[model samples]
Target: MIEVLGENFIIQQIRDFEDSQFEQTFSGIDKATSNIKNIFESLANKSCKIVRYKKFKQKILNRKPWVDHEVRDLKKTIKPKGAKLRQEPFNLELKCNFFTHAEKL
Candidate 1:
């Protein structure tokens, strides 16, 4: 079963992070840029997830000669969106967007 409420809560957390601003600055010239690292680290620690998966032993397909950066990036972005669309098949907007992106590839 899809934990729709839990997913919505996670999405809300991401939205809140994007909506809020932090004033992370440090004193002294040498320490001026240090806070930026802390800011991003905090963001990752709070917002990102870790995944572990098992891989099957299989032969690799070599398509590097034809696939370009745009295709690679599009595939990367499409993966999670495709997963979400699967979970919420009734979401019309997401379905449309996913199909449009898939067409691009």
Candidate 2:
């Protein structure tokens, strides 16, 4: 096995052994690089690891129903009176009107 192409390449750094030592010459540099790549990939496959984790499921909630027509109409009526009361805080008529409409709820 060629040192720089196989698993122990980093320790040896392919020292001392000459280019003359190996009898096989690749047809081109690309083929030589591919053989080294294959050896590295095989070693990586043996050492690789996998990890998994659980995902949190958020709680789903049902939407509340909107106010019905009669209650909606009552709020519309009362809202203007309450606004007028706030503008004239000392007005007895507006205060009384707002309270009377509010109690109809």
Candidate 3:
């Protein structure tokens, strides 16, 4: 944004300089030198505002792409099955499927 502002400022200064009393070419060498100096002075005085540069921010999305309805349902069942394993053992097939699905991620 600062770069855009600076560019516009320079363009405005140049237009103002061109619109002023200075001629494109002078009759004498001294007159030409003086005109050049005046132009330089005008540009030098019209300084751009000093602004701090801004850093770009990136958006982060926290989501598990692999977790579908099936995965969610499996997770719901797995918690109870895991707890029940302390008393009576759960089915090995369900446990194997859960591990396989989790590892696929």
For model 2, how does the per-residue alpha-carbon lDDT over 2-103 read when each residue is reduced to its tens digit? 433455653343342323244365555555566566655655555565456789898895543866777778989998888888899999988888888899
Candidate models: Cα lDDT each? 0.71, 0.65, 0.62
Q: Which candidate number would show the highest lDDT if scored against the true structure?
A: 1
lDDT of model 2, residue 10: 37
**Which rank order by lDDT, best down to worst?**
1, 2, 3
Worst 10 residues of 1 by lDDT: 25-34
Taking every candidate in turn, the Cα RMSD to the unseen true structure, in Å, is: 21.4, 14.3, 12.9
Give TM per candidate. 0.41, 0.37, 0.25
Per-residue lDDT over 14-94 for candidate 1, one digit per residue giving the tens place of the 0 to 100 score: 566556555554343334344445545555655667677999799887778879989999999899999999899999999
Colliding pairs, model 1: none
Worst 10 residues of 2 by lDDT: 11-20
Residue 80 in model 3: lDDT = 66
Quote the positional error of residue 104 for candidate 1 in Å: 0.8
| Residue 101, candidate 3: C-alpha displacement in angstroms | 10
Task: Put down candidate 3 lDDT per residue, 1-105, tens digits, no spaces.
Answer: 334436765567557656656456555556656656765565555554557899978879555997787877877776665665545457786677656655644
